[model samples]
Target chain A: MPKSNLDLINDCDSFPYDTFPSQQSAFTGYYTFLLPNDARPHGLLTSATVQSMPWTSDFRIDHSTKTVHLLPASHNPADLASSCTSALSNLITKAIQTNTFPILHGKHSEPYPILGAPKGPISIERFARSLFGLTARGAHLTVYTRTVHGLSIWVPRRSPTLFTYPHCLDTTVAGGVTTGEDPFTCIVREAAEEASLPEELVRTHARSCGVLSYMGLRDEARGGGGGEQGLVTPDLIYVFDLEVGEEVRLEPGDDEVEAFYLWDVETVRRGLAEGGFKTNSAVVMVDFLMRHGVVRPETEGDYVEIAMRMHRRLPFPVSARQVL
Target chain B: MPKSNLDLINDCDSFPYDTFPSQQSAFTGYYTFLLPNDARPHGLLTSATVQSMPWTSDFRIDHSTKTVHLLPASHNPADLASSCTSALSNLITKAIQTNTFPILHGKHSEPYPILGAPKGPISIERFARSLFGLTARGAHLTVYTRTVHGLSIWVPRRSPTLFTYPHCLDTTVAGGVTTGEDPFTCIVREAAEEASLPEELVRTHARSCGVLSYMGLRDEARGGGGGEQGLVTPDLIYVFDLEVGEEVRLEPGDDEVEAFYLWDVETVRRGLAEGGFKTNSAVVMVDFLMRHGVVRPETEGDYVEIAMRMHRRLPFPVSARQVL
Candidate 1:
């Protein structure tokens, strides 16, 4: 870290540059870590200075408050440099091996407590998640409503018996993607378990659109993984978006779903409007259907552009662009 | 596989109604198999033929000996007049798995095949390949030359290679995608590995004008899994035609090349006039580039135009209408 700028810039001798695609300027310089002056692993620069760094400065490490801040610039880099710091060496290794640098999305980003200060490899899999799965690791079957008449969603009331959230109108099907199983095949099995839909439904309704990656940060200062929990989980979740025709009835595979409803579109609208929805995920589902132009008719056989209308109604926090 | 026509076409129970996106009859069914009776896996099938009675028919049980197979049309209502046969069971299972369907451009296939039977997933991986880090698994990279002065290739002792059968050079910078990576990133890596060209040079000198998929089957039986060897390897390769700066020097990556040479239209014309060259795959590449103006020279540079014209001088064997 003490080397002159020019010396550091051309110091490609330590690492075999030919082995990787990176050039001198394209590659970040060598990195190292130093312990806190107090020698307390948890006692990082937790002084109060970070509480109020220059607003115009990129960011500051508010040691007194243990707050890592950020200063959003008008012009972002073509490929933003991520602060990669992990309490776990494996996560750090994984980050470098995979050619991805992670940065915490929220405030108090530890690895990057000081703005513009170089950080190390960041793992993307460090956040709180409810329900998630990997292909072959899990499967799902979505029952789409097709009728113009009326419909209801069948759900099982949690018994307050299970360790996790119980008694909920759960998705018809989901399971681990045991190694070696194709995702499409897994979905069919899940659909049958959830809705008693035929395996054929899976074959016909097979929709392997694409995948999306989500990354976040975890801080040990907040009493998270600093010692044993230092750093966070690194993972890749494979998502499958699929649907089955409305004609399919929800068949009981187990006590998973005690019942389902065949609700009409108006009932859904009413539920959304009244803020009476049980789970936010249901809203996500409704939004997906609406975006794809699936909705109820104004009257039997009457029509309204559901997808367009729903899109217009939603307040988008992100820009209207595909996931980069 | 024994049942009357009445039991076959009219029997609702034997039909796999569940496979239908709609209970309509217009849609087709496809299937896939992980392995043959011997337990080796291959590829997925793109087509199928079924018997009409009791939906009873036996599909091809072995290589070079395929037969019609009938399967239940739907599982929603399993009320067939007779018990299902092994053939029927296999067919129905295949249909439900969606392995019976083939992906477009999934592999290089001839425009036509005589067996008239669909390909199978008879699962297997590459048997023999290059031993270096650049080969093996689903990952690897290769670099070829591209048109610079004016779009023409010069071949030197081209033989045994899949394209440029007679060794007339053309289409540089072509390469393969490596494991755990997508094609977009692989090609750029290939260029660097082969020519030591910086990414900026490659990006600025090249353009991803378009893409195409093909299966290069020939006038012989194709070996699959443990079956007899075929003349082709099925790969979903993406073709990228590049245009480089005229002054750039050529650097061959490995011993795979005998030597490198840059040729203009007259040079190429002289080579072909003296001998002629055109590998089946090379023919396809050239046809693709020419038909799309992907390697047009007049617009590229005088040398490039001359080189492109030299390609035209080759006895392409097929007419523009035929190849185009």
Candidate 2:
């Protein structure tokens, strides 16, 4: 049986992309093997899609041949170009630095309305897959708390009862925006569903919004039935800045959730560098928060580091594709 | 005969809302009333949306008491409640702000899906009585240019053919972001269509997008048959941000333009504030640019500010039903 969604996310945490063998590209055989088969070549606005994709290039001692053969179900096609090349490349580059990888697994090709109906939710299969691996149809909202001292943050945690993932800890408030839902609505809703926080609580410290993108070159088709098999796809990733204050309560919905907490700068830095209690997503998020001065190492006023060890393994290639 | 679309848009440059006293509204009053019969509560979500939204009491001026009604929309419904208290109260609030005294207009409802299909363009009549306004259906894009300098900006001069107040002349390029198009595609396409510039010339600076609500708000329910009332009548407006450098050659699309030029920050500040040009869009845009610090006071730029201004007028109280 396929792993649970939570389990897949845990997989990403367990085997991150940054830990791949990246001394050179030519020798990284398995890394290149998982190039997404854009059968139709369109991901964003087309058909045929595969989420939580995991590309692994195992390390072997065969110094003579230096053989890095493609793994199971892996294919390299001259025509099956990438809808989003940068996503893969990002994973590879990060992998060379570390040995683990991240992955996303979801089904595709939702039936849009032919007679003026809103496109419905993604397949249940896909949702389940995302829990196990890195899932598509998700959004990231960074809550930058402007406190008396400085800025603070609130990151959501993944629940254990999740249909897919199990042990892995992942993004704070990341989830799919169903066709009809707006991005803002999506984030607020997800934060509530997974963590059981009130909408009013989340909206209190709202500040500004921004977007982020993860993309690379385009390639031919490697997918067939999904959205990216036939058309052009741009690997896109956008993040919104959801600001909150230091005096907020995060009501963890169920046992699925362990707790809701606060984060500071140094703690974030330590987590990213030392790996005391986190994953790549946490590390990247820490880096981004640091860049914006949204999270500081210390704070005097209303601030608390809810989880000194809030990081969990996810099943994704948290690093880049090229370096691996 | 009532005004047609071309007359309202191309001729008057005002939005086509449900009018009162024959001026889009519920009652036919002395002033061109909005909100009464106005179907569009939010007006148009156009380029001007940013300037006139959220209806903060800060912008309102109450002369009766010669004071700011920090909460003019404040209610005293406790004394007057019977059967429909909830519905009545909500309506009163909406109505009070719907036409904020001076402008008498604000916010619009979601659009009625005028065009049946998403792939191609279709002529959509906002409303049967909606004939008092214009119906525009098209897409726009914001392309960017690159330079060693921080960033390039285009300020248009008020277009000669456009008898409207701000014809996007002080800006470099302007157009609509039609349905089914993302920001990247929209900007590039708009650059090509409005300025006759190459799509590549316009590059993207940031993905952070803001809403520009204009006065125009399309409502399709009154479009005679009332069968397809809930049309996707967007509060039509442009969503874009692009860059153009000193070296790029720009040719305004003749179909929608008369001439084109460039301006620097100082030039814009001096000209727009001093009434050197004939468009109001420039001033607000300059304010937007200035507030955002996208451009500074002194820089090697190109622009000519149009002497455009905002709708100084607003909504007032009416209705003998309550006042009676």
Model 1 Cα lDDT, one tens digit per residue, B187-280: 6776676555577766554433222222222222321222212122223333444545556666666444445566665554444334333322
lDDT of each: 0.30, 0.33
Model 2: CA > 4 A from native: A1-40, A43-135, A156-170, A201-208, A215-237, A275-280, A283-287, A294-324, B1-324
lDDT of 1 at A136: 11
Question: lDDT tens string, model 2, A213-257?
Answer: 222112232221222222221111224455555665566665655
Chain A of candidate 2 gets a TM-score of 0.43
Query: Chain B in candidate 1 has what TM-score?
Result: 0.40
TM-score of chain B of each: 0.40, 0.40
DockQ of 1: 0.01
Predicted complexes: DockQ each: 0.01, 0.01
Candidate 1 Cα misplacement greater than 4 A, ranges: A1-324, B1-124, B128-170, B218-235, B266-281, B288-324
